[model samples]
Target chain A: MSNITNQSLSEILESIKSKKISSLELTQAYIKNIENAKKLNAFVTTTFDQALENAKKFDNKPNNEQLLSGVPLAVKDLFCTENVKTMAGSNILNNFVPSYESTVTKNLWNNGAFLLGKLNCDEFAMGSSNETSFFGNVINPIGDHLVPGGSSGGSSSALAADLTPATIGTDTGGSIRQPASFTGTVGLKPTYGLCSRWGIVAFASSLDQAGPMTKTVNDCSIMLEAMSGFDEKDSTSINKKKETYSKNLKDNIKGLKIGIPKEYRVDNMPKEIDELWEKGKKILKDLGAQLIDISLPHTKYALPTYYIVAPAEASSNLARYDGVRYGYRSQKGKDLIEMYENTRSEGFGDEVKRRILIGTYVLSSGYYDAYYLKAQKVRQLIKKDFDDSFTKVDAILTPSTPSSAFKIGEKTNDPVSMYLNDIFTVPVNLAGLPALSLPAGLDKQGYPLGLQLIGKALDEQKILNIGYAFEKNCGYKNEIKKWWS
Target chain B: MSLDKEKIKHVAKLARISVDEAKVDSLTKDLNSIFKFIEQLNELNTDKVEPLTSILNQSLRSRKDEISDGKIREKILKNSPKKNEEFFVVPKVIE
Candidate 1:
């Protein structure tokens, strides 16, 4: 049953329902692969023993009624799981285990999926490259030295490597979509409030959302249905009818209008990426979807705007970590104020601290109006750009990144350059819109390049349908060699 | 540059993260570069535009005044770095 570990989430569910494979057999295969793929550094914490126990329990009383149907999944460590250590790739929470489960993970468990382990991510989901993770960078399985696109890097790397069938990741300014693009997988960031934020370690509260990552678009649909819903506990969660995404996957898109945003064509973009965008447009056209050239005039300002808004919110959210209650407390403080200072200084990584300072500065007394409030006003204009464009197009199509995966340390020193990775994906988040990134094709060096479908807010179903049609006709099949094991 | 070592230090102090004296120079450089990039926002005039605190248009969600949850003190304190009985012990505040 080693091949079971290589199957899609939908395939695994079908196999289990047919009684062809037991949950134990499936979980064991994944556990064995995870043990051998230690070089990937994808997992921050392994729950193999607990996973086996749950699998055995499921095998004894298999229920085919659940959505996941006894599948095992590893998710980003940002989700707080009861009785398990949920570190947000920071030293501060290394010893802090949650006493409750996150709404998203709880939804997964209630759907019959058990935890496989916790995957690595950037510290508090801050960096574009997974390099900022305190657990260390998750190496892209595509190449030996490349950084898997990050914040949700471990989830992408592990999913692409077939270590887990389908996983979940949080997207705050492209954390989910960017990594999925680089890793040759499917990732979606639902509209701002599609999933609950409760029990997930807070990043930018307004922008942070958890969504599904998978090898195939259909599997992404299945996972999304199980993971999202309106929860009273999360005030931001949408209060609406539950979506049957997996049940509604359709390929016929005869008259769908897809906006091709002109501003996404940035200066000095790689030739291969331009060609990839062209190829994607042609594919969409051949699938009978009409393409319109549109402009999101505020595109260039989105990144700068995000840097201000995200960090401002992040600084406020992260102020909870002062070593008084949970997480790391420094041993070197003289008094109360010094203790708060010392704990934060030693506990957080450099990138985390950098953002905190930026946050603090922008929202500080004299700078608040010039920076934070100004960025927010500009953010409204950015959203208005999307709202106007949506009146003309059903969804917008763009490249997922300026380029494919880079070396781990290539842009770490220059924070601005690293931030440029999210240029194409950030605008969708700013508008509180749903977007999906699917592997469109491979780059010249064989790294996967992705095409994004940005839908109007609360229109995840539309993008998923569009993604399904494109994936079927694009003829892009990702082939990965078992190099890590 | 609006951000010098002094500005970074001041902000770090406000955020309660002690800046290592050695990192102030590099931190100033990084922060100044970010602020420089952020200056691009001024290129667009956003007069009369309301700062978007959230994309959702709904008013602040309110719930009825009623007890929804409580009595999980042990669970809450389970994560405290230093706890004694019913309270999380912090550094001497009165001293």
Candidate 2:
């Protein structure tokens, strides 16, 4: 069971397809792992019974042609799963079950993947650490006290702990990649319009993208193919023909130019991370790729600009949570306005409230031009910086996080400290480009460190191909002892 | 440019998320720090720069005006905290 559970998504699918193991066996193994690893708090809602039923159905009628046939996936709780409690790690929607399915998850199911459970995330996918989750913080499976980088901490932890084969998570800022880096997994933030955002809980609508988190880059490619497609429901969704990423994956880059952005070297960066970046550059060089030193001059402004843009969009998106249609409501209110105020006040976590306030202040009458408008204009300069760099290189490389995973409560209180975690990753989001973080090396303390590969807009294949080749030769593997279990 | 307690309270009210009176000072402090950090954007001059309203710079794909989705009234009213016969039930608005 452990061997079956520990296999990557591609490997698991191979075994399932060859009839070496039934879907029921695979799903049961994952369920056992999920049940045993309850201390990690990686799961917000475990659909074990439903998962077992789905596995039985898949087994009862085998569909070997499906991309993820009988492969049970536990996604970040932000995706709206029909009839399942999709809370998006907030109390406001704790009991809200959607009748309709999110296009991404629907596409996953259509491709023969079924639900395992709902993984935990930061409240409204806002916080950098999972500490802000209404359910509770997800402990890093690598070490109990260490924090799993968030807001997709649970997806990363569960993937690392073998609770799920390969999972999908929403990356707004560094949600997917940072958690994956902390847990020594691979996470990709596909181009913004590549994956439809019709049903995922909106944090920053423009920055939010659903991507794969997996133990191997091959599995990430397989899962990304399963989750992405064009949907009329999502107006921002790209109408490009569906890309066959896995089938067309190419790693033979004799002279492909990969960018090494100089601006990513921030002040006080740990020596080990700097060393890891050098190590990553060596791996790409070893893979017959040319490294060019380039600059994204506006990189420093990414974090500040994100704080304004994300919250401004968040305030507007979350306005739908008013006590009228759905979700948790306060019973203490007398009037309609009071009901809305009280419901939101009581329902949301402190981090959420702070963001809403920040968002409102920025988008308010007098401050709109000063904050929101200025941030948008700066956003253009940031995008232009990437555009200039992409002209010189096919992809860029940088350290995933400033340092390895910190303790759970280390930076929870300090907003700026937490925001700084995404400094290396947020620039990609601001520019709405595709980027992936793959584990390249470990720090002195044996915690995994990641290196990012940023590609031009709608060029996920190029990044994934580079990542696949890198993963094959990186030599860095997850030595995470199953201490939590 | 610092936000006082009164300003924090006012912003929270405008956002429709009630902040406790006692917590206003701390909230104000946090907002001010965030604001201070955001002040870095002001260092760059954008006199002729256009705001990036779109990422892909593609126009929104519009559909026909005809209703493409609907008729699931029970589903629409299912998650409501309080619901009447067909519509969501909220506190009375008019006297």
Candidate 3:
């Protein structure tokens, strides 16, 4: 059953279809695993009875043909799940339950995917580590002491710990990829507008994208097929035809051109990561793909530009949480102003408050031109860098994160250090490109390292195909940490 | 680009959040440091550079100005802290 740790969605569904495993029994098994793995803190809430009831309904249906029928999956807390407490890892939303479901979650339910429960995340999906969550930090199931990357930390950790077969996570700036890298799992951030943002608790309107996190790239393809579609509710949702993402998994990659970004080979990168990247390039080369040198010279500006743009939009999006509206409101306030102040002050965590402050300052009247406008211009250059590079190569490659997972509390105090963690992954978000982080190898400390593949806008299929090719060639499956097993 | 204590307090107020006086000092220092780092952007010659808003330069699609169907008033008001029979209640704003 431990080999069930990384089963693809199709395999799991086949077992259920043949009556080899009952949906109730499968959900029960996952529930049992989650119960025993409580130390990992992978789940914020688990709806066992609800999930079982839903599974029983599916069991009775004789003619259901949904692709993800009876598959149990966890949702990141950022998406609004109707009637469930969808707190985006903050005290402010502690009591908030949406009356309507987020489009992504609703689509998943429509496809017959069982909703296990919501997972933990950083407050408003702001931090790179799970430590900022109001529900308490999630521990990496692979190792007890290492931090699970965030704001999708719980989703990644839950999948890694085998609490769920697959999970859905949203990425804006490296939320999905960074944590996926840390947990040695497959995480995909699809092109912007590929998934609707109507009910997603907005972090940054322009950058937020919902994607899948699973144990294998094949599972990611299956989950992505179910999660993505056009929605009239979201103005930015692209009206593109849908296709099976895993249809071309067996496609050949011979004569494929993979771009290796020169700028990502910065002087400050750790030596082990550099060597692993070289090894990854060689593996691709030996697998009949050609490596082409590319340049994204504006790479150094990605972190600064992202910080300014994301926070500015976050400040605006979070303004909806004033005391009068839905969410936690202060009980002992004398007046409306005091109520507003007290509610937000007590509800939001430190990191959220810090971002809100920075956001407000940058978008303020006098500083808007100096900071926000400048960052916007730099954003154009960053996108241009990718545009120019894509003209030369099919996809761009770089180390997902500069280093492996850092110890908890290592860079929490220094905000700059924390922001640097997303340096390589942010540019892709800026350009609205599709990127996937696949485990390449392990660092000296035995911590997992990830190599990122970035494709052009709306080219998610290509990135997944490339990731599939790499997975086949590498055949690299390290043993899950003893604790997870 | 140095943010003083007063500027930090003002920014916090503008953001509608409260900050402790002691914490304000550290926030000022941190904001100043970040701003100084961002000052590197000033070195690039961007006189003719246009600010990019969206990744694709395509224009936003416009729908006809017609009333459609969406009025979840009850659902929207369900989570409000203070609400009346048909509307959300709040403290008086005007004297």
Candidate 4:
């Protein structure tokens, strides 16, 4: 049963084209899977009728050349969908439906991708585990009680559970990649501005980037092609000419130089993870790629610096959700100030409030120079570490997470422990580099371990090519099928 | 790096968030512990390092200052708490 679940997106598309199955039937199958796997809590909202109608439209359309035509995909609930409730996993947005669609969702639909549903997530994309979501936590597909990481936990779980062929997820500080690692799927966080952020419920505006979550690297490449482009409406959108991302998948990796960062292999890393890194190195070396030892010495400082910078930006971006304009308003308020305070206090989850407060403190006049400005300087040094390493290596490889998925509620009580889960993935975001997580091997507990590939900005194709080649060689895809059954 | 109850209250107010009196003591303890941990960054030698506001070193490209579709009245109003025919409604502040 898991065998069929592990089929690549390209194979599914071919099966649809040969009339072996219709898009409507495929959508129905996934929707049925979602219903059967309800205990996983992978989805926050399911659009059964809209998905069926869209699949029917795909059948009637004369053109079928689009790469993702008829593919059933789940969108993280953070993205706004027209007439559908986009909750961002918070009660404040429980009943709020945007009349306009997010640019990413609109692009997917325009490219013939069908929406399966909106997946669950951390409230406003704030937590490392799925536990903070207003909707109940999403469980890992492989183990019923284990966590699917967040804030894109639902997207990762859906892909892992065979509920969808692919999904769109937003990554601000490992929201996408960390969860993908937890669930043993492929997740990409393209260079910031590669994908338009217009209509995405803002979390940390400067750091947020959206990408695809799928069972294979090639599937992610195809989905990324459909999702990325320049947009006039988004101020941060890059103005580069559009190009096909999947075109470089078959490129040779024989001479590729992969860098192993000494700093990442720190004293605190578990022995199993260290062994996994060694295994990854051996595999790459066997493929005729050169391995070079490099140093990102500033790595330890990245986590602390990101906490300051991301929260500072988030504090400002989340300010728009006041009671008067939109979203939740407290009923007990007697005046405007009371209403504003009461609404946010009641509407936001504890983590969101914590971040807003931390952000406000760092950005305050007295401490701005000491905390926020200092963190920014460290951010530059962090980017330089990667920049200096890239000069010596064609690409960099690291474990996607410090360890595999932990059980739900294991670290929820301690925010610091939860933040450490993204320690390896955050620096890639801070540098605005393209990175992805590919299933490497299984840990002792049978949960999947993911190996990450980091590339120079706009060199996403290089990393995808390397990952696709690794997938072909490693063949972890077969093991995934067993979990589905 | 120790966050006192007074500091937590002041920060919450600056962020426009209201914390009940009972919660302030707990928040202070939590913030203090977190800040104490993060204060390890102070030990790093970053004297000459330049601050990076954005990873992209290039200047942002400016778009033409022409309005295309500046209005989405109906769509924007869909999430509004209180709205008249043409504008959102808020409490009057004028005396």
Which should have the higher lDDT, number 1 or number 4? 1
Candidate 3: interface RMSD equals 1.5
The sequence of per-residue lDDT tens digits that candidate 3 reaches over residues A311-359 is: 8999999998887868888785667777777788888988898888889
Model 2 / residue A79 / CA error / Å? 0.3
Q: DockQ, in order, for the candidates?
A: 0.86, 0.88, 0.64, 0.68
Residues B1-95 of candidate 3: C-alpha lDDT, one tens digit per residue? 68888888888888888777777777777777767766777766666889997775566778889989668788889998889978877766656
For every candidate, the chain B TM-score is 0.91, 0.93, 0.84, 0.88
> Scored by Cα lDDT, where does model 3 land?
0.86
Off by over 4 Å in 2: none
Which ranges in model 4 have alpha carbons more than 4 Å from their true place?
A: A1-6, A478-485
Q: lDDT of all the models against the reference?
A: 0.92, 0.91, 0.86, 0.86
True contacts kept of each: 0.90, 0.89, 0.53, 0.58
Instruction: Rank candidates by DockQ, best first.
Output: 2, 1, 4, 3
Segments in model 1 whose C-alpha atoms lie over 4 Å from true places: none
* Candidate 4 local lDDT, A368-432, one digit each (tens): 98888889888899899989988999899999999899988899778888898989999998899
Q: How close is candidate 1 to the true structure, as a TM-score?
A: 0.99
RMSD of each: 0.9, 0.9, 1.6, 1.9
Clashes of each: 0, 0, 0, 5
Give per-residue CA lDDT, model 1, range A192-233, as digits (tens). Answer: 899999999999998999999998889999999999999889
